[model samples]
Target: MQSAFEKSISPLGLSFRIWGITQLVFSTLVTALLMQVDVLPDITVVYYVPLISAFLGLPAWLILRIALGLLASSRLNVRSRLDRLRWVIVVLGCGYGLAAGLVLVVLWQQSVTGFLTGFALLNAAFFIGCITQHSVIMAYFHVKPHPTAEARPTPAAIHQEQNRTLKKSYMEQTNKVLYKAIITALLILLLLIPSVFIQNLVQERKSRQAEVVHEVSSRWAAGQTLSGFYLYLPYVVSGTTDSGKPYRIEKQLIVLPEEANVQSVMEPEVRPRSIYKVLLYKSRNVFRGQFRIAPQGDFNLSLVKWQDARLCLNISDIKGIEEKVLVKLQDQQYEMQPGTPETGFGNSGLSLPLASVAEVINGPVSFESVLRLKGSEQLHFLPLAGNSIFTISSPWPSPSFDGSYLPGTREVSDSGFQAKWSFSKANLPFNTYLSDTKFDAGKFGFGITMVQPADQYAKTERSVKYAILVIGLTFSLFFIMEQILKKPVHPVQYVLIGLALTIFYTLLLSISEFLFFDWAYLIAATATIVLITWYVRGHFKSFRTAALLGAVITMLYGFIFVLVRLEDTALLIGSIGLFLILGLAMYGSRKVNWYGNEQQQDQPRLASTE
Candidate 1:
């Protein structure tokens, strides 16, 4: 038996060196890809930053190296040296494990499940490396040594020794070839890391799309928010000074209507600007409301100059008004002026001066108005009355109801949509009376957003988010094929395959601009699958392997499409999908002799000597 110091030197030193070099190259590539996401054009989506996955590769490489070292030292039969080396491996492995755990904690702060998935993959790599290294070492130890001079007297014994040496040489050659294939496969996986930059490219393109939308919206009319027809009453409060002198102060009182109602019909049109399209609409609206003044018993009306009261309607964008607004107060019609009575009412609106206040002070006052407005994207309303009711109908198929309140009743179809909203002071934060303060009426009401059902850029961004998984799985599939077939695949071929995968996104993004998202995905995925299948068939010279790969690609693309469309259930579906994929991989590789079958085949030759 060899002493511990004698057997300490690993027979697979060259293999470990190759693995280390490959790991270094992979680390560099992963780091470069991670940096690319930071430089991508600014877009906000809660996505797993590919950088987290990239950093995990570093610890994985370290753990693998330590595991290989441990396996190498395990060949020593002597107790003392083996014990010391084992402790060294334990320390190094623990340190690396702690570092990896810290990284996972940081990732957990950003996203819980992302961290869990990453940690699981990292541990899987480490354990797989441990198993592979241990098996190779065990196989090396099992090889029988040449016969000693004391046993080599007979001619038969000499021939048997020769045969044993030949078998050992063959096993060594086989091990070298297997190790080289593994290193090559790992290198191919490393090369696929750069494909993550394609996601950044997708984001940049999406940013440009947003810029175009903004340009178009700014040229037409931005989204409009119509606040109200509030009563603006200017008054004077008299007070006695400390010096016994009389003083009067000017003030304005803003009173909301007791009840208000609005009816609007919007005609929507799609305007194309370059390759992007924006939603715009022309709205014809009718506003009717009633304002009632409390009697003397309810409150003091002595200071109110009711005659000086003016009816003001708040419009967000005066430029969007398509027709002249006319107001009818108490059966008397008055055309509204361009500016508001006081700065108390917003700047961009029209106001009508009342002729008398005696009737208004005595009882309830009624008013009506007609307005024709043109706006882009969205139409928002403010709940400025004690009880407000708004009804809207449009020929737009997609409407996103956005704001503090949702529509009480809504009906939508392929042809059109109709929505109604009801709000009261009880539900609102503020009371009916307001004065001298700037109020954000937008926060209190519902808005109708005329939206495009499929935003190609957004969908493309979503698709790009899954690039890492797609590339990783595809590479794993090819690696498994290489192992099973025992065929050598060049690193360059792997790069070409990864590039083909990366180009899928760019194709999807460009095609979706002209076609629907679903159709674009189909066309892009099919073209990519066919191209890869043909390329793989040519490389492997096997139709079965190529067909299987094509089917896998098809299934992956289909799975991702389903994930994107079903956003709410994506996590559940993705988790289950991943579990099934892992199960399939485990099952397929169950019979693989990771240690090489040459050791088992040569076992009988050694037994014959005994």
Candidate 2:
């Protein structure tokens, strides 16, 4: 048998001159392939440009030459060197193939075919060159010398030498694996640099949508928030000044209702602006309350002018009030007009003077009004009475109950939604009557927003936030597959996968502008899954391996999509899901042998798709 110290050629020893000739031949083949495709219309691109790109490999060639030279001197033994050599060849082929695929996507419609043909040729050339180089290296495998060893083991010393070899091999394999894992982790972090831009893109798109909504809402009415039907009574008070002179001053007493209830029926409309849709609504509202006309304890009853009392209602957006507002007090009708009455409303509101003192002088009298208003986004009601109850119904299924309080009773489904709120003196933060103070009515109000369910941008943004999880788990999966198949996947391949994941967000954002968010998510996820699945299949040449990866990718995307749509329980569910993912990853890697510890490699063996 030949000694291990015998002279042999490594694939790495394929020399600068021979490699250049092979590269040129490959480039020429690529050019020829491009020439056959009809996509080349211009004479220069047809004849000259593609030929030039072949020679363009000189730069990459020189760089890879320096890298291989450095790797030749590494501490890795013969088997390790051979394994790494095969890995490099695999990467070379896959790198070109993936580049070809990406170019096919990014290329213009006009010249895509010819360009893709050239790239396909490049990929095939690399693949054939890699396989031929592997075969040559394997031909001299028995006689290949360890870079450090000076002599081959004699048959009598083989058993003793085997133990030493195993120890050394174990150390080499451990270091190699540890180093690769570290590089993969770092690559995961590096790939996140691009995901930052993806986040910015998501935000930029969301902001654009916001701008569209604002533009539409500017022409349409803004959100509506309704406050009290205040009973404003102006009285003349007779008081003595510091100089002891008698003076008469007009004093205002504000009285709130004992109980108030509002009923609103909202008809939602979606207004499209460019690529965005703004939610707007026309609401028919009825306000009913009962009031006690009792003045302040300090004030004389004779000074109170009940007839001149103005009943005012504060509407956050008066422009939204569509029609005439009519008030019915004690079964008498009174029309309200915009702007302040007597002691000015101090806000944008409507006011109406009582028909007569007889309307409320007897005792507590019930007051009613019908208001038809147009609004956008949301509607709110302030609890400005001792007891307040609000009932609102809409055909909109996705209503967000926002602000300080939630609806006590609510019904929501695909068909429609109805919500009712009840607030008593204990629940309200304000007093029933305003003696001489200004209260911010909006403070304790509760309302509902006509939220577009599963807002595409919002979901995309949430998905972007989980980029690390997607990329990290995917890289881990690929790494695990490498151990299982005993074939090393390159860092660049992992980067491409990360890039594909990031691109999925952009796809979702763009598509969801026209279609529903769920459909857009499904489409984007499918496209990305198909693409990555195809690329993975090209690498391993096994349908089962590619399908395994595709299934995992699908599950990851599906899980993220679910997390995005679940607003209320996202945090809890995400935490649980991540824990489970960690468990599954651990389970997947449980039996994976990091090093060929138990099994013996009689020779330096390298696996090949061929």
Candidate 3:
């Protein structure tokens, strides 16, 4: 056999570079493959954006490696120098690739617990990649020099030395794997115990919060002040003005209800709180200069404002109408507006609130009226009412909309206008509707009105889902960045970030119970962003990087604000953001080269001073 003095190349040098190139190519291919997968018909295309983001780093990273490789070849000739930089880049690229794969797998096909399990598997892959790179670097440096006494080693001896290096690398890799297995097991056990407890606590808190909200809503509706008004006009100035003298409108509205019950009527709150009240007036049809009350045509009656519901009239037909006409308290006056010749209520004459109205937080109510014009001329009130204007019960008496109130199959009843709605704790509005429902008095126009709670729980659930999706997408984008840039991100950092985002919902729910949702969101988002930004600075070594991430986090939180506020258009906005991010990444990576180290080698240039 030849002596051990002969020179030889390290097998590690060949294998390590090959392995690095393979990993880069493999990662890039996987990312492209994942992005190209067709989304199932039933699944929303937006849901795939996170998975796409997780994979986006692979191609960019590979191109970076290629650039590093070209730089190294042109400048560095020594294996030791090139290998050191190569190991760092290789390990970083592999670690990022494995991490992104794990994130995609977790998001696409697993529960929260299962996703964490996937993360542990990902960590194992990372450790394996790290050991592979480390071993090659260590083996290259570990060779013992031959003794000078042995003269010079032959080529055969050099071959034997290369075999030794290979064996040592194998041993080192095996030890690394064994250590990783032991640590992984221990970590799994430790995390599992706490994870179970934490998850249970979260579930319990959600249950308790939902229950409290229901109870609060029930009490609020029950405690609302109940009050309304009733009117009775016994005496009236039923008259017609002179021909040119702007119809001398004179009348005395004797508050009949006031005289009937002086004690109750004079009560501070009960005495017609509204400044406007209903009034009754009648005019007779008569010939010119003749004083004969004739019920020939329609009569004019209207409401006027004094301190209470009163009357105002404009008599246009005094030619065949008498100067004086009799008036009667024919119906309950919710609100009455008498029509004139100038503005005649088409066909039918005056509208009178004839039915007794009762206010209830129960089912909605429907009210009907007849604009009677003398001998029974009737116009059927169409299904023209909406919202709180009328409570049209479906299935005759049941308080529901869809259970019995189908669109085409409506049944007209004595109840005038038809309006349908559902009412319960589950039906209360959560976000924008809260302001509309809570603040609007729900009394307007010329229809009967009702109030009922909407689907509050459904509203809350939708908001929460979108919030979760936004945070999930944000995390995915960050994960992709970490992979492409080979940024160091610890598990603890991920946990803290997730916790910061998760707390946003809790904050929103708690603050919104008493304060307005807008204000609540502002306080919660600002606090969470500050906490996360501070924590991110700890994760990243540089303050500039931390501030950059802080800005991203701030923008993400603001993005969620738009999602929550613009419920109808949130999905569209989120899609546009995804497209923009993809475009940005593509543009940034256009000139990058693969098959190289992460850090470029500094080229030595001749200087005049030297």
Top candidate when judged by TM-score against the true structure: 1
Ten residues in sequence with the least summed lDDT for candidate 2: 601-610
How close to the true structure is residue 171 of candidate 2, measured as C-alpha lDDT? 66
- Report backbone clashes per prediction: 0, 0, 39
Q: Encode model 2's per-residue lDDT on 24-114: one tens digit a residue.
A: 5565664544444334566466466445655655654664565555556677666767666555654554465456545534432424332
Number of the top candidate by lDDT? 2
Write the residue-wise lDDT of candidate 1 on 1-610 in tens digits: 6556336645446235434443343334323433454532333321333444445445544554565556555644433333343344334434544454465456344343233333333333443444455544454344335576664358777778787777665655556555555444444334333434555676777788788877877777778888779877667778789999999887776778989999989999888878778788999989999987663222346666766777788787888888778888788777887777644335678877664534544467888988999898889888889998999999998999998888999999998999999988788787677765466565566779998998887788778777767877887788778767877677678778888888898899889988999999999999999999999999899999999989988999999999888878899999999999989988987765444554445342442543
What lDDT would candidate 1 get against the real structure?
0.69
Error of 3 at 91 (Å): 22
Q: Alpha-carbon error at 486 in model 3, in Å? A: 5.0
- Model 1 CA lDDT for position 175: 60
lDDT of 3 by residue, 266-299 (tens): 0001111122111111211111110111111221
Error of 2 at 78 (Å): 16
CA lDDT of each prediction against the hidden true structure: 0.69, 0.73, 0.38
